[model samples]
Every structure is written in structure tokens, then in C-alpha cells.
Target: MKTARRYLASEIYRTTIAVILVLLGLFIFFDMIDALDNLNEKFTFVSLLYVQALQIPNRLYDLLPICVLIGTVIALAGLAQRNELVILRVSGISSKRLLWMLWLITIPFMIFAAFVSEVVTPYTEKKTSEFTISALGKNSTKMDSGYWFREPVDDAHYRVINIRRLNSSTEIDTITIFEYNTQDNQLSSVTNAAKGILQHGELRLDNVTTRTLTSNLAQVLTNEQAPLESISSLKTQKTISFKTSLTSERLVATELQPDKMSTPDLLNYVQYLEENNLQANRHIVALWRKGSYPFTLLVMITLAAPIGFVQSRKGGVGAKIFLGILIGIIFFMANQLALNVGMLNNLPPWLTALLPNIIALILAFGALYLMERRSKPRNFIHAK
Candidate 1:
């Protein structure tokens, strides 16, 4: 049993590495082709290549589970084709034992996935985004409307901040802030700044203009009364300091997509959003999905295990690989669909994330059970 386990582990690891390399190369090639359209005097082909290289971790993180599935299927199907699987079974390794061995072998992969997702992917993704943005000379392309944040001032007041572009970690441009009165649910003020510097928990706005709506003006606006001089009073300042709870770290965190954030950062951001009474459903879903990734990979391996039991007479290795790919695609689509539908309908974050994995596990276990049932009759006949 030890020897069998070692052999299976070796085969799966070797095949998985090969698959990773092949898929990574293919993806890089596609990236190169796509990068062509973005080429310019400043953003040359080499710079684009460097950006693509930086994105490799994210690509690998996304592809790991599917690669594992395909590799497992190929390894097992090849063994079955050569009758090695039959020999192992005849040597008294039951199907259940083999399944357990596969799961055991998958532990290292789960660890690797966690490492990549938590450590490697986030750093590399941020670097890639920063590099691409710098190379392209684009300011606010990370988000179309800009990076928005909501900070509560008090029970009856809050501020909505919109930064058109982040020049750097400490610098911002085209800043717009909307201050609202929660008691009346009315906009109380709008602050616009040409640029800003963030330091020491204070944002210093240069060339600032603030429009404050008086109570009468607010009432007039709410009543749809049109009067030119009834407009809110506008105050301009050369420089103004605004204190905020958003530090540079929190600012950067808000700028990144939830998937590009580490789990801890994501959790913190989710809490921040909830505390500010902002919409965090999407981030919540992403948080749950990232947490459930290991289980998803386990399900992928389980799904692959049954494919290896097929004889060469029934289907070739190519067919089995194709089936593996199909399964992977289906799983990806189902997971995405669940995410979208769940977020749209406001489903629980954990349920939204784990629904597809649960369904896949059921299907995988059903396949395993059927395979075990078929093997039992054959084993009984052989014993008789």
C-alpha cells in the first residue's frame, strides 16, 4: 500500500507539473497576442512581456485546480490503459483505499493553492496592475468611475469620496467628496479638489472648492424650486486638510479588487464596508469563495478519480482528458453562475460560494459509488 501510494503520488505530481508548464506557456502566448494592441512608444513589447510575467502567479493560481484535475485524470487513465490499476486492485488495494490515497496525495496541492492565493497572487497582481497602469500612462483605469469610499462622520453625517485617479500611494487627483445629512437623507455639501496628498491620517487638498447647502437651499432643492441665487454657497480654498479613517493602507486596499486582496485584507475591508454601511456583498462573496477554494480542489480531484477507472477499451486517454476538461469548464461556469445569481438575489455569502462545490461533490461521489458498485460484482465473481 505504501509503494502504491508513493507511485501514484509521483505520477500525479509529475503530470501536474507538466500540465502547469504547458498551460502556462499557452496562456502567456495568448497574452502576448493580446498585448499587441496595447503596444506604443512608451509601452513597448518588452514592457508588456514583463507585465505578463508579473501576472503569471495570478494565472497559475486560477488554473491550478483544473490542471490538477486534468493531470490526475491523465495519470490514472494511463495507468488503467496499461493494466497497472488492475494489478494494484488485484494486489488488494480496494477502490475506497485508492480514493483515500488520492485525497492524501492532494494535501500538498491544497497547501500550494493556499500559499499562492494568500501570498503570491495578491502581491504579484498588485504589482502587475501598478506596472500596467504606469506603463500605459492611465490614471483611473482600475475603476471606470474612480475609487469610491464611504466614511461615516457621525450618526447623522457621512462622507462619500471619489478619486478620479491615484497618482501614487500618497497622491491623488480629481478628488470629489459628497457629504450627506443622514437625518434628512440629503446632500449637505460637495467638495472638489484638483489634487491631494495623504499623510498622517489627513488628506490635504490643493485647489479646493466646497459647496455647502443651507437648510433653506436644501428644502428648496427637495421641493424642486428653481432659483439661480438659491444655489448652495461655494467656498474655495488653496489648501484644506480633511481628517479621515482611511489610511494609505486602507486606501490601497480599497483600490484593489477583492480577489487581488489577501484573505485577511479582504476580511478587514469587508468589515470596514459593513461598518460604514456600504455595499459589500460582492466582496463578501469573494471572501467566502477564497476560503472554500481548498474544498473545491478536493472536489476536482474526486471528480477526476472516477475517470481513471475507465478501461482503454471503453475510451482512450484523449477521451478521458477531454472529459476532464469538460468537467473543469462546467465546474468553472457553475461556480461563476452561482456567484452571480447569489449576489444578485442577496444569498448568504457562504452558501453562494459553497453551492457549486457541494453540487460537484455530490456528482463526484455518485460517480465513485457507481464505480465501486460495478467493481464489487466483478470482484465477487473473481473470488468465486
Candidate 2:
């Protein structure tokens, strides 16, 4: 059994690697074409190629499970085609043991995936973002204060502006807010002399003037701005100011971009997102989706083992491989759909992420079980 297991494992590993290379080639070919249009100016061929290469790892990270499934299915199918599985079956190789061996193959892949996401993805994404900005000749794109984001809010659009500044110690100093109306899409109200300071475990923005047009006849009914001193009497607060010498790690929480965050950071951010009435389900789902990868490879192996061994199955090898691809595509779609729906409907974060895996596992297990039952010999009796 040990010898047989090693042989099968070696074959499965080789086949899986081959499939990964083919998939990676396809991804690179398309990505290079996409990168070509941006090859001029800041996006040079070298930078573009490097960026694309950096991007491939993340893409591979995302595509790992499917790749595993395809490779496993193909490998198993080949063995079945050559009647090798039947020979192995006659040598005391039970379906359960085969499943266990497949699971073992996934363990290493899962560890590799965890390392990739934890150490590699964040670094690469940061590099990619920086490359994009540097290529465009922008010093800094982060709009802290004196920043404005315009978007449609309710019946009208507003250009929300912040006149924000940080002290030498990297603390929020003075913040000014401005709101522009979209009815005429003109600057209607300017709320200035505002500030953001740390207060009672929360980042508080003071001197706020929630202003708007009261009538369609070009009139401002309300424009209010209060000073920090006015709100100072409300509580005991430590004056916080921004310092210019702060690093990214010190000023911003890593959880802001959960995908770029490490596992621990992602988990923490998910908690923060949940408490803040934000859509954490999607981010949490992504984290889960990433985390589940190595296990997924094992699942693919388990799934492939039975399908590959079924000599009397109706489908041809191409058809079987096509079926595997379809399954992969469906899993991807279902995972994405669950994320969107869970975010929109406020479902539990973990459940949204686990939905696809759970479904796929059930299908794979059931198929494997049925195949095993059929493969059992007619003269065999229950040992119990």
C-alpha cells in the first residue's frame, strides 16, 4: 500500500504541475496583450512585464484549486484508461486510503498558498500600486486632507472635500469639509474649521456642517460649523496630531485593504468591518476562499480518484475533463455570487465564504462514495 501510494502520489504531483504550467502560460499570454496598450510613457515594457509577472503569482493563487482539480482528474483518468487503477484496486488499495493520500498532497499546497498570501501578495500589490503611480509621475496619490471625492448621494451628487493636515508626529490636526451640490453641480456650501481628533477610542471628526439646499430655487437654508472649543466641553480628549515621519504601518491599519493584508490582519479587519456596518462578507469570503485553496486541491484529488477509476462511465476523457472545467467555473461563480448576496443581505461572514466549498465537497464525496460502492466485489462480506 505504501509503495502504491508513493507511485500514485508521484504521478499526481507531476500531472498537477504540468496542468499549472499550461494554465500559467495561457494567463501570461492574455495578460501580456493587455499590458501592451499601456507600454508607453510610465508603463515601459520592462516594468509592464515585471508587473505582469508579479500579477501572475496572485492569479495562480486564485486559480490553484481549479488547476489542482484539472490536473488530478486528468492524471486519474489516464490511470483508468490504462487499467492501472483496477490493478491497484486488486492490490488492497481501498477508496478511503486513496482519498487520504490525495488529502496529504493538498497539505503542502495549502502551506505554500498561506505563505504566498501572507508574505507575497501584499508586497506585490504594494509594488504594483507604486509602479502604477511612479510610472504616471505621481509623488503620492493618497488624499488624506485637502482631498475630495465626488459621488452621487441620495437625490443629488456631492463633491465632499476635506482640508486635512497632520502634525510632525503623524496626528490628525485640522480638517475642513466642503460639500458641493449637483442640482446645479455647483459649490453650494463650504464647512470649514473642522478637525479630526482621537476621542474615547474613536476617531472623531468635529466642526461638521451637514448642509444642503432646502429648495430647488438656488437657496442654502442651513450652513453650520462649530469650533473644537465648542465641542471640547463634551468630554476628556487627548489632542492628536499627525507627524510627517510616520510610516505606512504606523498611520494606516493594514486591514483597510483586506486582500493585501496578512491572515491575522485580514481576520482583524473582518472584525472591524463587521462592527462598522460595512460589507465584510465579501472580504471575509475572499480570505476564506484563499485559505481554502490547499484543501481544495486535496478535494480535487479525491474527486478525480473516483471519476478517473470508473472504467464504465459514459463520458470520454475529453468530456470528463470538460466536466471538471465546468465544475470549476460553477464553483467560481457560486463563490462570487454568495459573496455578493451575503454582503447585500448581511449574512454571516464565514458562511458566505464556506458556501461553495461545502457544496463542492458534498458533490465530490457523494460521487466518490457511489463509485466505491459499485467497485466493491460481489463475493465480499462485511467484516462486522
Candidate 3:
């Protein structure tokens, strides 16, 4: 029994790693090619490699489900083909015991995945975005108040927008902007808005006050290239709309793509949106979806056991493997489709996140029960 359990664990581990590595290598090759095609002024070969390296965790997080499904099915099918499972069964290892071993094999991976998604993936994603944004030619200025980044309009003008907290697509909170004269290297003026929003591809500021700093603007123009204007001393809001290349859709995508955020960050952002009276259904769904990853992996273990061994009554190994692949595709699509539906229809987030896993488990247990019932009875009278 001990040897059998060890064999089972080793086989599953080896197969899972092999599948993951193959998938990652293929993905990395394509991604690197795409990056090389999009190469710009800021990204060197080394920097591009670093960016792609940071992307691996996210890719792994996305691919883990199918890997688990395929790996477990193939591992078990290998054992069955070699007749090792038949030997174990003759040695009085019941179907329940085999299922238990499968679950046990998946436990360590479940723990590892929980830590990766909650910590490693989020951290790496932040780094990836920071590098990408820096490559896009933006600079940040720190102030006593929250800092803003400079988005260049052209050679002689740029927009300095400070965002304290992003509320939602509808409203951005505590945003302040200082439009600067780049050629003169002087402060044009200062505008502070409690909330700024997008309306028809234009920015509208709310609770605004404007301060005209043109009086001392000459004193601040000390350098042509070093154009860091101090706007914290100005306590005023201004209605200044210098049409930036950043649209509402782009702004939201940069800051609020929940896939790139940690679970807690997504939750806080969702609450911030709700407080400011904005729609956060999609963010809510993303939060729970990230939180469900480990649980989904565990559910996949239960799912693999029945399906992997179901071929004892069916055709060949290829047939069973093909069936497993089909089931995995269906499960993945169903789960993704549920999340999309929830986001679009404003359905409950947690329910949508969990529906596919729940369905998979129920089907697994049902199949396991049927497999047990149809198997040869354990009791047999010895005739001497």
C-alpha cells in the first residue's frame, strides 16, 4: 500500500510538471516573438526578457486547471495500461481507496497554488505593468499630496494628473492636474478636482477650484529639460481640459484590470467604486474568481479520479485521454462563460465564481458512484 501510494504521487507530480513546462515554453516563445515585433525606443532585449519573465506566473495561473486535468488523467491511464492498478485492486485496494490516494496527491499542489496566486502572481503582475508603463514614456513626480504622472501631449505641453484613489470607470477620486509649459519650463496653472470623470471622450472635473500661478511662473522656469513644477503649495481647483491621449477606456484598463490586481486590492477597489456609486460587478466577479483558484484545483482532483479510471470499461488509452481533454475544455469554457455572464448581467459574483467547480464535483461523485456499482463485487466464496 505504501509503495503504491508513493508511485501514484510520483507519477502525478512528474506528469504535471512536464505538461506545465511544455505549455510554458510554447507560450514564452510566442510571447517573446510578439514583444520583439512591438519593440520600441525604451525596451532593450534584456528589459524585454525581464518583462516576459514577470509574465510567467500569470500564465501559469491561467494554465493550471487544464494542466491538472490532463496530467492526472494521463498519469492514471498510464497506471491502468501497465496493469499496476489491476494489481492494486487484486491486493484489496477498493475504488474508494484509489480515490483517496488521488485526493492526497493533489493536496501539496493545492497549498502551493494558494500561495502563488495570492502573493507571487500579484507581485509579478505589478512589476510587469510598471515596466510596461515606464517603457511607454511616462515620468512620476512626488508631492506632499499624492503624486501624478506626466503624460506628454507634444513637445511643448504635458498634463500632470494626480490620482489619490480610483473609484470606478465613472469617477476618479482626489484627482489634481497641473498643465505645464514644457518649452518655457514653467507652471501654466493649477487645477484640483475632488473627482474627475470622462464624458464623451472628454474629462469633466467636479468640486473644482482654480488658482492662477502665472504671477510667479517665471521664477519656476529655471531649466528647459528639468520641468518639475511644485503645485502642492497651490490650494485651488481649476477647470482645465487639455485633451490627453488617455481616454476613459484606456484609463480604466490601466488601473482597474482585476486580473492584474491582487484579491484584496480588487475587493478594496470594488468597495471604493460602490461608495462612489459606480458599477463594480465585474470587479467583484474577478475578486471571487481569483479567490476560487485553489478550490478549483482541488475540485479538479476529484474530477480526474472517476474520468481517468472510467476507461476500464471503455476502449483504449487514447480514447480515455481524448475524453479527458474534451471534459477539461468544457469545464474551462463553462467557468469563463459564467463569469462573463455574471459581469454583464450583474448577477451574484461568488455564485458565478463557484458554479463550475460545484458542478464538476457533483458529476465526479456521481460517476465514481456508478463506477463502484458496476464493478465486480468484493465478496467471493473460496471453493477448495
Give the per-residue Cα lDDT of candidate 1 at 260: 63
lDDT, model 2, position 299: 63
Runs in model 2 lying further than 4 Å from the true structure: 137-257, 267-281, 312-315, 377-384
Q: lDDT by residue for model 3 over 243-269, one digit each (tens)? A: 554454445444425765777767666
- Residue runs of model 3 more than 4 Å from their true location after superposition: 138-256, 311-315, 377-384
lDDT of 1 by residue, 1-384 (tens): 888999999999999999999999999999889879989998998898888888899889889989999999999999998899989988888888999999999999999998998999889877776665556645664568888888988888999999988766677889999998888778989999999999998999999999998655556757765675646788999999968877766766755667667998888888888988888999988888888887778999999999987666655999999999999999889988998899889999999999999998999889989988887798799899
Candidate 2 lDDT trough over 10 residues, lowest sum = 228-237
Which of the two, 2 or 3, has more lDDT?
A: 3
TM-score of structure candidate 2: 0.70
Q: Tell me, by TM-score, which candidate is best.
A: 1
Ranking by lDDT: 1, 3, 2
Whole-model lDDT values for every prediction: 0.86, 0.62, 0.74
Q: Any residue pairs clashing in model 3, and if so which?
A: 191-238, 192-237, 209-237, 209-238, 210-237
Q: Candidate 2 lDDT, tens digit per residue, 290-347?
A: 6765566666666666666677444467877887788778877887798789888888
Compared with the true structure, model 1 gives a TM-score of 0.93
